[model samples]
Target: MLTLTDSAMSKSVSISNIRLYQFIREKCKIAVVEKNQATDDPSIFTQPKEKWVTMIVNNSFLLNLFIEDIDFKETCREEQEKLEKEKKRLDNNSVKKRPKCQQNYITSKTNHDNCHYHGAFVYDMNNHCKLTREQAQTMTQNVKLIASNSASGRSMELPKLIWDCCLGLYGIDPPCQVGSCGLPNEMKGQAIKPGQDLMTLVQNLFMNNQAAEKRTKDFS
Candidate 1:
């Protein structure tokens, strides 16, 4: 039920870009799956959350995702039931649908090897598949897609933790000389590389002025 946004709604993309998105993601079908169309919430992407959208097609364009803001759960009974139904459907109709002269697609690993697939065919492994290492990787990704993590009930909190450790830990001050409060880190300036001088340093310091000032204050 997620709608494309201004940054991601483009209809045309280079074939390589599309492949990048797909490469990072396992299955595009379920990366943002909805249970039902009518009652489904369209607000998943609008929430203040960091969502990841990986597609093989757009290799470089990692789009943000919209999902339910809360963690959810359901009785496994229905899911199990649907999978069983899918198995039966494939078993009953695959022979008629598959062509005899069709090229073998999923030629990677047997059993779980093979190529990327979707729907009932994914769950029912005996269906059409591609037989290459690439296909194997694709199939692996699809399974991961179906195992979507939308049920988790928290915002994208992990990133906050990372930012806290890397930036907040420095207490909004310089790189060294204890801190505005008192803590110790290596008080020396960063090592310079050969041929790198004031101009290069200036560009780098633009982003870390606070750190430079803090360092100066510390040393003085």
Candidate 2:
């Protein structure tokens, strides 16, 4: 019978070795013929032939299977390493730096002149147009007083007070005026007339409770 040596038997049988042996037995007619010849040669006592030719053929078959297994494992390892490298590269690319303006929006002490301006009390691109802290406080007080008077149904002094807040004494332009310090054209229309009433202005700017609430929150 064909048998492996003690040392060969002691070696572990890998999956590749079994698969290769099955392939050779099923598909390789020439190799099968050669193996049969080698197997029968020993029994026939062929003239001037090597002693263990069948053993050599079996060892060579095992060696080929072992080589195939090693190559397959090495290729798999190389592919895995390439995929890991690609993953790391993509992870590195995914990280992005934030914009300088957005990163320092709240903490930055430096004023940005290019940024849009809203009103006198609020900071604007033109720092010269921005009101001082004292002026802002006084405006807030004036607004509160106006709101109080309106709540009390005191309509007599409202026009004068509103005009003073907009144009006359305070010299503060209405927030709905066009230009850099004013709201966008979509939000505000043509500049306020010399004697436009506060209710009319409020209705024009804030047509909904949501907008009015937002304005109130901003003031608060």
Candidate 3:
């Protein structure tokens, strides 16, 4: 009888390595040709993850079924709760007061000419139509990056949109890269080039071939 040796494992066969598919393949091993039995290679990216629930007896395979984004609505609700809680916490505090005139919604409705000016306040403070600390804090509640529709059950999520920017805001790189945000190495110049946008250049992102050549020349 011809028998395979343990030390010659490389010469022996590995009919199938999939734990899930092992039984079916083993049953077929009785009929499969020797050369065809051990050549199936599994892909790392495409393999199934091992799944099971602990029970008293031997572990058994589960009939896994596919489902859509089950946790999306739950995740949205959680984030919304977090955002509202943060807003509520900041509602009452030593907030800087804003002038009543600046708090008015309409410029056309306000009598800007004679008495009701935009800057007059109860404490004789001037206002600039800016939100108070409390108001600013509360603004975050309504001003969410994720829209309310994002929580709707029927909504489909497109692949997340990612854009390279000098600053992080609204989950997208903000176009406001000048003045005080510590501008990136690229696009920080006084003026943008013709046909070039502000986001085109970035520091350390370009090749340093010339600098390397100079370094090599100096070292030699």
Q: Output the better candidate (1/2) by lDDT.
A: 2
lDDT (10s digit) by residue, model 1, range 19-44? 54454344433323333334367765
* Top-scoring candidate (lDDT): 2
lDDT of each: 0.32, 0.38, 0.30
Worst 10 residues of 3 by lDDT: 116-125
Per-residue error for 13 in candidate 3, Å, reads 53
- Off-target runs (Cα >4 Å) in candidate 1 are 1-64, 68-74, 96-220
Worst 10 residues of 1 by lDDT: 157-166
- Model 1 TM-score, 2 decimals: 0.14
For model 2, the superposed segments whose C-alpha errors exceed 4 Å read 1-114, 118-134, 149-151, 155-220
Arrange candidates, best lDDT first. Answer: 2, 1, 3
* Candidate 3 local lDDT, residue 155: 39
Error of 3 at 98 (Å): 3.9
- TM-score versus the correct structure, for each prediction: 0.14, 0.16, 0.14
lDDT of 2: 0.38
Cα lDDT tens digits for candidate 2, 1-220: 1234457448443444565556644443222211124554555744332222132344565667544533322234456899998887775555332121112222122233423222222322223233432444476677668777786765333221111112222235433322222233444566667875533343334333344334434543
Compared with the true structure, model 2 gives a TM-score of 0.16
